[model samples]
Target chain A: MSPFVLDDRLERDSEFVTALGLCQLRLLKDSRWPWLMLVPQRAGKTEIFELTPLDQAMLTFEANLVAGALKQVTGAKKINVGALGNIVSQLHVHVVARHEGDPNWPGPIWGFGTAVPYDNDRKHAFLTALNEAIGS
Target chain B: MSPFVLDDRLERDSEFVTALGLCQLRLLKDSRWPWLMLVPQRAGKTEIFELTPLDQAMLTFEANLVAGALKQVTGAKKINVGALGNIVSQLHVHVVARHEGDPNWPGPIWGFGTAVPYDNDRKHAFLTALNEAIGS
Candidate 1:
């Protein structure tokens, strides 16, 4: 197994959630929507296609698992799964639980309204529920 | 081999480019940015996790291939890949090429501005060059 080192951008933008089997689940500090970013624990990897065939299957499985958990917790109207390496060139997947009437409804949630950092109580509650939902 | 039936939204929203062995490539008709959508031919699928292990690997391969082609042809500053089935339930992956000074710039492109439809000549040139770039 390759030792995974997270990029600085991801580190700065997110708070630690927990570790999954194949990826690190980080809570995006934005608190805009119930967003979770899954970065596969592979060093120097920046794209999904870089994974081996078996690893591709694993990442897809993990992404689905994480996204489903987020959707259930948030009752999201939709879930947006994206790997855009525009700012951060890390191979991380954003599994965002989209709610209706959100600040940027029916749009991609990147670089939208100022991200509100999660308050202490709200963050604790959300993380606890997320951990339960993800069965981690 | 399964015959691919395009979802109505895909048909209306994109123009066909070419096909890799595992997926079809289409340019997202929103002239807002150089974007491509990859849809695997498996009928009635609505999510990436729903794909078989083999199909998942194949889709990943094809998505990267198409993304690379788009990036080269457009000289995009970044590439955004996503599979969000919010409005349309069909399984489609978006590979968008982001420029530095695009209208949305650092923001997500969804719902930012009205998509400028590609005129005939422009669309034709883009399609032809994309096809060539992908070595189709």
Candidate 2:
């Protein structure tokens, strides 16, 4: 495990999934879509450039792993993966599965409509399947 | 070097800057912003999972290297990086340096405005500095 701390914004917003090599994968609380976030457990690292080359590589692996599983498990039409630090500024990679008619179909998902927080039972089932898919 | 080929869409749209591991870094001919695209030269590969683990790691290193250089050379306020395969599903990574009031502030830069292509002299100068910055 890394000597890193989770950002308060992420902790408060997301439900913890599991940890990968250099990232802690979290499920965004939004029930509108299947979205997973990989937060690198590197302290004070807001940008990808701030990470060591090795950590960067490991991050890529973990990002791909999570994205692949998310796509397969959800049967999404498309998968969008990005690391945008405009608002949170904490180095978090978002892996979102997109469908043809999802709320924000053709545009970037940031600053979109309100997030529908997941209910307890649904969140449990979804996370359980996701954990198995990601082999966590 | 791997036997990778550039996609036709990228070749027609972008100006070749240099080659990094797992990608060919190109300047998205738009002069309005300092935008660069890293297209993984792996032929016919559209997803990150298609890449070998080592190549994925190498791609991460290259993306960070280019992003770091771009941030320094442009003195940007923040850098936006993502692998959005919406239009062209050829697995290209975008590394854009964003300023506070650069046309689209506090938002994603995709499809914001018309792209103003760079002129020969300006492109040459910019790429020259970029080459040194990224150690190409």
lDDT of 2 by residue, A1-136 (tens): 4567777888988878887888888899898888889999888887898988778878888889888888888887677888878778879998988877887776767768889988889888878888899888
**What TM-score would every model get versus the actual structure?**
0.84, 0.90
lDDT of 1: 0.82
Encode model 2's per-residue lDDT on B1-136: one tens digit a residue: 5566677887887878887767889999788789999988787676787788877878888889898999888998788898767667778888998888887777888767888978889888888888999988
The residue pairs in collision within model 1 are: none
- Residue-wise lDDT of candidate 1 within A4-122, one digit each (tens)? 88999899999788988788889888877888899988887766767776677788878888877877788776778999877787789999887778876776788776888888899
Q: Clashes per prediction?
A: 0, 0
- Per-residue error at A2 for model 2, in Å? 12
What local distance difference test score does each model get? 0.82, 0.83
lDDT of 1 by residue, B1-136 (tens): 6666899888998877787887888888788898888888888787676688778778877887787788788988778899877778778998988989887776666667677888889888988888898888
* lDDT score for candidate 2 against the true structure: 0.83
